[model samples]
Target: MKQTGVAILGAGRWGKHLVRNFLAHPDACLVAVVDPYPETLAAIKDKYNLAPEVRLATDWESIRDLPTIEAVVIATPAVTHYTIIKDALNQGKHVLAEKPLTLDVAECLELCHLAQENQRQLMVDHTYLFHPAVKRAQEVVHSGCLGDLRYGYAARTNLGPVRQDVDSLWDLAIHDIAIFNHCLGQLPVQVQANGRVWLQFQKEFQVSQLPVEKEFQVSQLPVESSEDNQGCSQSLTPQQPANLPYGNAKGEQPANLQPANLQPSTPQPSTPQGLADLVQLTLSYPTGFQAFIHLCWLNPDKQRRLGIVGTQGTLIFDEMVAQAPLTIQHGYFEQNGSTLSLLVNIVKFLISNHLNHFIQYAIAFLTVSACPNLHQYLLVWVGAQLVQILSCLSQSLHQGGVPVTVPQLPK
Candidate 1:
């Protein structure tokens, strides 16, 4: 097999995992690892025992133009995505960007157009969509095994590694939203959201109610540390993450890394002044299916769970469950059951364990390199669609939980 030469643009937590997977793949030749932090690159090099033939650099440009490098894997901040991806596509390098494609929908579409024009494959690493469990859930939901769709709910929360560049809505909600759209088979048309900013902004929760009365409450906890990508720095600093090329202590861009013609005159805010640690989202699909998502960075209860309730039963995808991460319970509803009781919920639930779907993601890029047309360009569209929903959700959340309509993708 002719190896596809690849370079990883960010070697942070998530990017390092990409590095590992790409290295393990027989068809991928990882030629370089790029990040602003030298220590991060050094750590990756030492950790992987990378060959001297592979390049390591602080700037992607230094290595991107290499003759051997045919593609770039981008796992940088949302703010930097537009500039870097635009550059990569313009240079005719196939790109595998991290989620949200870009913070803006227009940028995403532009990149999509650019990729098509350049005849290059542009994909986003929406890793959750690659999960075997999610794939199984998709089969169950699409096969009508779950019956008439009623509603869906997902909760993603963590104690720390909260990012300083973007909020939980930007960081955590994308995973669940991607899953929701995939299983539901359509993008959300409308969104109603509100958020609480505590760890980053320290603002009081501007409480709002969903149409239906909800009965739940969580005690807020606060922590101060800036870290993490698709999910960053060894020391979680402000905008100065270990993976991105953020300027200085004051958050200025280095002259070398400044956006050229490819960048927008005014880039979107890297960190919102009202950045929320917790966000409540209600996504309304065209089929009248609504999925509620709870996103939080201050909570210690590490949860990666999503459920779609149909007339027959619910399809549950819970990563925390070791035995069976994906399951479908047939016939009837069970309510008011404590979270712990779910472990012993009888023969009705908990599907078999899934393979490491994260590695499967690496194979996606290699496959794209081999056959761009057969490559599921839907992944790119899905990434863009998620960004569209997120853009609407951001507006609605900041407006005191008012409902916002998610935009339809332009033809």
Candidate 2:
């Protein structure tokens, strides 16, 4: 096999994982590792025992124009994705960028156009899409074993590694969004989002060692009580005034015991302008399938789990479950002549009209089930999706700058 010369940009954190994977692949040749930090480059070089042929550069510009390099794997921050990917594509190099192709949707579209024009492969590193558990789930869905996918819910949370540039949505939920799109074989038509700011600090703050009462008092409420006061009943009641204009016989306000005007001794710095630490998003698909994603950076324990619900069965993928990460519970409801006979009759009538459609669906289900290698088919399916996007973009390009219909899966 002809080896593809590849250069990896950014050598810190996740970049090192990409470096190891690319190096392990037989078809890839690590030509260069680029980063602005010398310590990272030195660490990577020493750990990987990089050959003299592999060039280490402080800037990507040094390797972007090199003809020897046929591909660029970008693992830098989301903000730098646009410039680095655009430059790599412009240089006729196949580009694989980390998720959220670009911070802005317009930039993402432009990069796709550039890649199409250059006839290069433009892929986003939705690593979960390649996971064995996720692949199995996709197979289960495609096989119609779960019947019709009604909805999906994903929760991805961790305690630390809070990013300042992008919020929990872009940093964490994007993975689940991509996975949902890939598994459902469609994109969301509408999305609703809600988020909250739990922490004002830019860096991750440790709350494990600090006393819970003290931390909560400092961050959340202005509780003016001594450490000896174990509960609110002990301290809050005595702090109330003995007599009040709108107080009851017990001297407590009829409405509620409102806290006095208590403020922090020192005003904490304002929260930096950045993404939210907690975000909840609900996506609606044209097929009437809905997905809910919950992401948080301040969670006590790390969690990565997805649940898929259908009429026939339920599928769960719990990454934390080491013994059995993927599980399917068979379930189905049979409609018979009961108290709700009228509803059952109506459902039967509706299903009768769609007999032909159901037959075609059944054929597809059997075809998928008969396939010996589902993983290969999934790869081809993903590739086909990419090709479809490129084809649409190429048509748009030929039509003189009309907008291209980008696919739902980030890239």
Candidate 3:
């Protein structure tokens, strides 16, 4: 195997993981780790025992000046992707970048074009597409076991934590969008969606009927109660919560509460109830195959599950199960609705229990094998699917639940 010198930009969480993986890969030489944070650079140097020759630079100038650095893996923020990737390609280096190639569509297109102009490979790190269970599901879908593709749905959500700079769609939903595109091999024609911001300084919620009823009741609550006092209760339904003045008077508007005084009492509209803290987005394909994606940052469980339904059968991939089986249901909805069955066990093939199945697959194909071209092609698929998913999602956020068409990259 020919050794390729690789440099990792960003020593943050994901960046460190990439650094560790590349350091362990026999075919890769860890050229450097770049980050602006001094602590991050010191931590990487101490934790990984980086060689003296492996330069740690805080700026792009130093990175470009490194001797014999042939490639760069960018784990920086989306805003910096266009510049960094453009520079890397211009330098005649192959590149792998994290999702959301760029925050702006025009910039993303420019980056792609630059890569082509330079004849450099521009790969996106969409981890899910390489997942063992997802891979199994893709194989089954292509095998005709699922019959004619009908509709596919997925949800990735949790309410426990919110991001500072990005929305639920970008932070989490992007993963499923990539998977959706990968499974369907096409993008949605149009997208219309509604979103709400809650629990953050900035909020963008969907406009819905629930807000009308809530606003009516909040107006009836104590006039002095600041909206902040009502912020915690915003998650409540029309039925007033306990310990609040509105709870005692059911179905009766408080007589003392006046519309004028209601100015302070009237709550600011936030996200909608039952909107899944995340979302369940439906993607329509020209072939009549529909895909639904549900993502949440609020679910109590830490599990990623995917289900694909076709005209003849169904496929389920759950990460929690011991074997993480890629179960298939064939002849579904038949005379007896066919039968429930476990089709295959793809998780065991993973290199270890600690590493994710997808990472293992990438490592296997990229380093421990002779399938360089094959692995490169897979990276391209991951990148293109990611671009489509996010594009549709952006459309959905702008439009009102209108379907959006996903675009394809030129071969």
Candidate 4:
């Protein structure tokens, strides 16, 4: 097996998972690890039991001089992703970084263009996509078992893994968002979101007197009124907000709107519901296919589940517990008509074949040879989810819960 010398950046929570996975892969050789903090680097090194020759750097600069590093896996903050990945691509190294590409769209486009120009592969480490169930779901959808995909949806939620750098969408929903596209065979036409901002006004408000409604102002778009007393009303149209400045917009009021007043509305503010981290989206295609995605981080049961409903049949994927294989249902003849029955246990099938397929595709791409019949349509579908995520978030903030149109990918 040809070993690819790989370096891992960021030894935080997710970094450890990448390190362990890469170490297990026969085709990958873990060469260097980088992190700014001494403690984090030390913990990973001690845990992985690395040799003295395995370079550990407190800064990215130290490893730049190493000519042997063939690829870099960036597990750093969302803010630094573009710079690091751009530098790596510029140096002609392959990249397998985390999602959201960049916190904003411009950087993402720049990275995408750079990868194409350099002929270097830029695979986001959306590990859920590699799951057997997800692979099976994609297969059924593309293989015509599901017929024409009518709609698609997914849920990825958890109580406490929140980060201030990116919202629930970038942090958790990106996984399902990516997978939704993979299974549906289209990009989202529109995206909108509804979320709460705990610290919108920051220290300006007497936090004690503030009603939860005012505290949890929808992050979509601001409500505008001729008068403040008329009650701030905004439309939640479904259009994804692109290139959001990372949490830096705090304390600033929504455009054309004033800072929220702490006084409760008439009839008293409703009992403060827990934080709402839900993002719902829809997509439309010229071919008449539609996709809807609902992602909530508030679910007590942190399961990653998706359902693809179509004309002929449906494909359901459950990623709640590890090792639970994807179960498939296809149309079958009972006595006189059609009935649904299990076709395959997806988990076992994928665990046995997905990586091998990836390896074959990679080799084919490098050798300029005809590759095995695998589904690249999944990539086309994922692109749609990314667009819808931004569109829905934009609409949910301004419009009163309406679906927005997603921009079409350049043909």
The 0-to-1 C-alpha lDDT of every candidate, in the order given, reads: 0.67, 0.55, 0.56, 0.52
Clash count list over all predictions: 2, 0, 37, 31
| lDDT minimum window of 10 residues, candidate 4 | 226-235
Q: Write the per-residue lDDT of candidate 3 for residues 1-411, one digit (tens) a residue.
A: 677778877776567677888888776788887776566689889999999999887666677856567777777655456678888888888777766565555566677677667777677666766665666666777788777877776655432333323445655666666666666666666544455433232333332101211222323333221111111111112343322211111124435435464232222233332222355577666677777676655454555666787767777765556464466776645343576544432233232243354444554443442334346434444565455556566556645555566666555
- Candidate 2, number of clashes: 0
TM-score for all predictions?
0.79, 0.65, 0.72, 0.68
**Candidate 3 residue 324 C-alpha distance from true site, Å:** 1.6
Per-residue alpha-carbon lDDT of candidate 1 for residues 1-411, written as tens digits (9 for 90 to 100): 688899887776667767888898887888888777787778888999999999988887677678888888887655567888889888878888777677778788888888878888888877666666777788888889667999999988777544445667876787888889877778888898876654334322221210111111122334333222341222224334444442212223233332242121231232234557678889998999999999876667878788999877687888778668877777755466553222223233444422245555545654554433324534477778787888788778777777787767984
Better of 1 and 2 by TM-score: 1
Query: Native-vs-model 2 lDDT?
Result: 0.55
What C-alpha lDDT, on a 0 to 100 scale, does residue 352 get in candidate 3? 26
- Taking the tens digit of each residue's C-alpha lDDT, what string does model 4 give over 1-411? 567778887765556666776777666778898865566678878998987878888667678667778787776544556678888889888776655455555456667778778887665544556656777778777799766667766665544322222344444556666677666555655555544433222222111121111112323334221110111111111121322111111123334433354212232111112223454555555566665565544445555677777666666776544455465555532343565544432323334444444433433332332334433422222333363355355445335455566555442
What are the runs in model 4 whose C-alpha is more than 4 Å off?
A: 195-276, 331-392, 395-399
Model 1 lDDT, full chain set: 0.67
Model 2 TM-score, 2 decimals: 0.65
Candidate rank order under TM-score = 1, 3, 4, 2
- Model 3 error, position 185 (Å): 2.9
